[model samples]
Target: MKRSVIPREFFCRYTPEVASDLVGCRLVRVIRGRRISGIVVETEAYRGPKDPASHAYRGKTSRNGVMFGPPGHAYVYFTMGMHFCLNVTTEPTGTPGAVLLRAIEPEEGIAVMVKNRGPIAVDRLASGPGNLTKALGIGKELDGEDLVMSDRIFLEHGRMAREIGTSPRVGVSAGRSTRWRFFERGNRFVSRGRPSSPQNP
Candidate 1:
């Protein structure tokens, strides 16, 4: 199949829209000349300043400066001193917004994903943000990389989810009422996590 990279314009909108629309898109990463990819299954939007759960909520730092840069770029960050999470920058230039890629359904390069992630169930290989990055061999090196024009990593058009579900973002205390988490309903590859508080109707 001919794969078309998602344009930068696609991410130059509201952060929540980009997060929701990213579901079912393909995230491709090239490692050692091999392509490892999967269909995006879950995401969470973070609007800077307004979103208390966002890294850019306070202001831009050396680590989060990329989020204040142009859209369609990768914003990778280390968390808990162990895991690296992958997020795609959203909104227009100078706007601090991003969509955290929560999970993905493994598509191509299963063996490589298995190797990268160790012996795990196919569905679990990329079922969480950290795991998804590990499975695709993504790390701090790809931070701030241009997803729209980069050959090493990029997004592609894929099968859209038939049913998308929404909920409050997991592990966040402040944005409990905001339903910014989006996932493909009934997708086995989607991560399993509940919000810190009840979601508002």
Candidate 2:
């Protein structure tokens, strides 16, 4: 079951579109010849500079400049001054849009993931953005890495989710009105299992 890497064109769409479509895709990280991967189960979209919850909403800066570049790049950022969160840049070049990879269902390198996130239930290993990044060894050094071509990390095409759920994004002080969070219906790995109305991208 060798999956093909998802192409850059897949991420060139609107951030919400990319976020919704990203469910069930594979998020992979390669370290020292070992591959750790998971099925993307949750995502939150941050629309361009207008979306106040987005880091780019305030316009590009030294930290968020990568998000304004071409789509299909990694947008890793340190949050809460302690943990890292991973996002994928989206939209046309110069547009500041991205999809936060909120959660994933572990598929490979379970041993490594367990090592990073010790003594946790398997499904809980990557149940949140910070947890997922820690399990997959993603950090600030991976910021701006091109996902379309990076050998260390990249997305792979996986089975599309037959059912998807949508709801307002979690943990955002602003842009709470935007129902841009998406997750695989009934996926236990999702950070928040509660489902609202389904959205069609």
Candidate 3:
């Protein structure tokens, strides 16, 4: 498949707006000579210091400094000491904000994803953040990488999601009342099933 990368300016918008708009867009990863791709299906927004659920809420640190960098960069981070999750920086430089790429519908390189995840059902190949990263071979090494120009991984233009659902973010202890999670409604590949509300036409 051809890759038409999204430009840097696209991510300079508000975190939640970017997160909602990301659904159905293509995330591509080029590993060696192979191409692995998927359609983004679910995302959660983090709005810098004011949002308690955000890693940058407490303030910037060596681990989270990337969140303060310019938009359109990868913010891959380790979670639970066992899994990696992928996020894209949002807003502008000096302001920390991001969108967590929660789920994806695998589009290419199924064999590699299956090999990495081991005999999982096809629908669940990249159904969650950790799983998505594993499927695409994304890890800490790609942290702070520019997604707009990175040869390893980048986002491409895909059809915008027509029906979008919003809800309180999952797996976060704080900011539980904030409806920052966005996903494609009725998409079986979405990371979670319950939609607290509907947003976008």
Please report the candidate that would top lDDT against the real structure: 1
lDDT of 3 at 15: 93
Q: Residue pairs in steric clash, candidate 3?
A: none
Q: What is the lDDT of residue 90 in candidate 3?
A: 95
- lDDT per residue for candidate 3 within 71-188, as digits (tens), equals 9999999999889999999998999999999999888899999998999898999998988998888889999999998989999987878698888888888999899998998888
Task: Specify the highest-TM-score model's number.
Answer: 1
Q: In order, what lDDT does every prediction score?
A: 0.90, 0.89, 0.90
Cα distance off (Å), candidate 3, residue 152: 0.5
Runs in model 3 with CA error above 4 Å?
1-3, 193-201
Q: For model 1, which pairs clash?
A: none
Window of ten residues with lowest summed lDDT in model 3: 192-201
Report the lDDT tens digits of candidate 1 across residue range 1-201: 655999999999999999999999999998788888999999999988888999999999999999999999999999989899999999989999999998999888999999988998998999888888888888899999999999999999999698888988887889788989998888888888753433232
- Tens digits of lDDT, candidate 2, 1-201: 755999899999988999999998999999998999999999999976678898887787899998889999999989988889999999899888999999999999999999999988998999989999999999889999999889999999877797988888888889978889998888888885334533333
